[model samples]
Target: MSHRFLAKQWSLIYVRDVLRVLVARDFKLRYKRSVLGIAWSLLVPLAQLAVMYIVFKEILRLTIPHYTSFLLAGILPWIWFQSSLITSSMTIVENRELVKQVGFPIAVLPTVTVLSQMIHFLLALPILAVFLLIDGLRPTLALVALPLVILVQFALTVSLAYIVATLQVKFRDTQYLVGICLLLFSYLTPVFWDFSGIPEPFYSIFMLNPMACLLTAYRAILLHGQLPAAKPLAALAVLSSMVLSSGCIVFLRARDRFVEEL
Candidate 1:
């Protein structure tokens, strides 16, 4: 509720330090009492890949070459997207004491959530690389575009995080709703299956999902060794920018009210 604090620029040097500390604290707290510690980050996605591979590749006998690698590529980014939203959605409410006590930019809370999960996502990438090598898949020159893909995904995730975190401060059920939507979204995304079978107008509609476009790009670079087509890539770039700009607008508008709501 302090006007001066609200007026403070979020780009201040101290704000960067606070963001670093908050991200580290979240990362440590996530694994604090665990037996395997950081290993769990690597294990969780690999385990999910195993079960999904078995069910889809073995039981249903869906034949896609190097299916394990394909699944790994999609699942890693999806996990980051899903977990970031789940945790970030409650960040403001969970840290109400800090919100009331601090005058710093409150937006850092959701940024920290996305960054923390990004660490897990990065850790899981080596596993995907190993799978690619084992499958005799050498990444092409198109692999250089991966950083751009990651940037796009990060923008989208953080934008959604900001919106959800700000809203959940007022409506406590937002987290539950996010969970249900993420569950449904997993099926809608091309995580376990190929997008080629989607067919017609539905395929075009599905491509509009930013996550779908992102996952497709990931598979293109890591699995298929090619860049995503310019059309979808351009669409993703436009969408990410819009989401980021709008999310910042929404979060800043709601930020002043967060303390009272909390």
Candidate 2:
């Protein structure tokens, strides 16, 4: 039993090390030829914020108070979700060499994609903080809830990543379909707009989207300086847990056949 326990512990450590290496490799390859390097993480969101501000505030004439803060809270998280899903969808196919290795943790490919994008999200938060300060939204004890919110979003993204990655292995079109779905989801989610104006069934429908709930929680904590509603947040956590379990099962079962497909 003791020998078995030690072996299990060592296996976990090996997986951890492999995950770390893959994530680092992704980060380097992502920005390797770039001049701005990691600064692109900060800049990309800001650029998106600028476009959103122009479209919503300037063109659509939205009168949202502290609109910059509102937009940043939404855009930063959404970008992380969008980028992770798209990239992870292709991760297994892109790393056919690694997937060919026997006993490899195939799930780590999608996980690495999600985590690397998450780091980008965290890096952009300071910019959001600056905007929040500019808008006079002082830091509150509500800030303490931010990490929990991040963890919930992380779980949700990683779960979806696993599902999409598995699908992409079998169906090459999965990447394009995911891209189109994400495009629709961006508008469906309140990334550039507030859901308050949305009426009954629509509001209820939007809430059904986990990303909608996650974004709402983010806006509440960062912009409004408070915790999100308990019921929805708890529901999201539960839903994410279920999806993750399902995703892992699907990925593991499909993995043995992956080599044949590839």
Candidate 3:
């Protein structure tokens, strides 16, 4: 029942082509009637960033140097994860007809959702770059490590997406639960504020969250022009790998039941 055994076998392998097709089809279907096409994905995050910048910098007078830059480091990735999860949570259920009509891999559901959002994040990078320039910040060579940060983020977000999608299919309350959890977790993480705001005992605990490590490193490289300290980077590497491995296991376990449930 592992299916892991058949992963490479032609008959059992979930070919990459299948995933590509699903992603392509889903992306087109997503923006079909929209004038903006795929641009909508980046637009939402950009709009949110503008609102936050106006409120925090103008109204609250909370002047953090390179404030918008600091936020871009957090917000783009946050939107990617949040957006993907929100859309993916119902992917299987929404594609119920496809599930019964096609015998293809059910695991493709979450991957396709994540890929579409990834495309959006890529488009928004120029917008983030503009904020960095306005803050008089020039990215260092360490900026190349942006891909590594994205790699860690993808590992965590996709894994969570897979687990959530399956759970949402079985338990309708899962979406509401995820919304509440995301609300608390975003605040708990240093997305809007800095680590200075977190209390003593909580500091060590909160750092254990991968998002903490990712955002912290992103800020360091983009703003400070130095590499992320070894400890946090290592922690995220360990955490991301574990989550990715487990996500695959969890997806395989539920996929069979998904087709039946559909």
Candidate 4:
């Protein structure tokens, strides 16, 4: 019955309610202003897929098999991760008023931004299903692995958001740094090209990215109707866990000063 443990449990309660409220508010605000409303979520990812398909499949003459469906599989998760992280970086700054006033727990802010994006992503699944069907893809029991992929993705993203949001709040430059990291990491990841298609040395070097493992699983399930190899998934789980634990430690230390900084 330590006081610290009780305080943390209380904060977790606040976070759960706060996350739901923020998600609902974001859904309302995003669609309320536009005629097409939430359709934009589906459209945006579809447009990105179309452009990549045309550019890579047609223009570059890259003969990737089942390229259309494969791209969507990889890109949707990437878009979710990118969109969430970019928005989460500014979570505290955007809520500066709340930080200054009232005794709201600041840790909830990152979860809020991530949860809002999750709502949009869930709505986009039907659109993904349409394109997936058009590509002659059908459901398989292997699809059960998909949820595991999403769970790992959530763990990874939550950690990154917690760490980066804290840094962004403390040092303004960290915000810009996150943007730059995203730009560079996208190229490094196997979004446009598959490691399997490449020759040895380069493929070996590229597979080192943990996200490449996730991207591979996505393409395998969506295009090939197969499950991810357990080894890579295990590696990612370990790496993500380490990152997440470090993020929590950093957040806990920095959270104490957030109200004063704001």
User: Which residue pairs of candidate 3 clash?
Assistant: none
| lDDT per residue (tens digit) for residues 1-262 in model 3 | 3556445533534567777788788878879999988778777877878898898889987857788898888898888888888888988899888777645566777888898788788888898888888889887998888888887788788888988987887899888888888888898777767785668898888888888888888888888888877787877778777877787798777887877777
> Residue-wise lDDT of candidate 1 within 175-214, one digit each (tens)?
9999999999999999989887767999999888888899
Q: Which stretches of candidate 4 lie over 4 Å from their true place?
A: 1-14
Taking all chains together, each candidate's TM-score versus the true structure is: 0.95, 0.94, 0.89, 0.92
Best by lDDT: 2
Q: Which pairs of residues clash in candidate 1, taking residues 3 or more apart in a chain or in different chains?
A: none
Expressed as tens digits, the lDDT of each residue in 1-262 for candidate 4 is: 3457537656666777877887787789778989998788888888988899889988997877777777877788888888889888888888888767555666677877877787777777777778789978898889999889888888888889999899888898887888889989998998877769779898877887877888998777777889988888888888889998899889978887887887
lDDT of each: 0.89, 0.90, 0.81, 0.82
Tens-digit lDDT track of model 2 for 5-73 = 434544878889998999999889989999989998888889989998999899999989999999999
**Which regions in candidate 3 have their CA more than 4 angstroms from the true location?**
1-14, 101-103, 197-200
| lDDT-better candidate, 3 vs 4 | 4
| Cα displacement (Å) at residue 24, model 4 | 1.2
Look at candidate 3 and tell me the lDDT of residue 32. Answer: 95
In candidate 1, stretches whose alpha carbon ends up further than 4 angstroms from where it belongs are 1-9
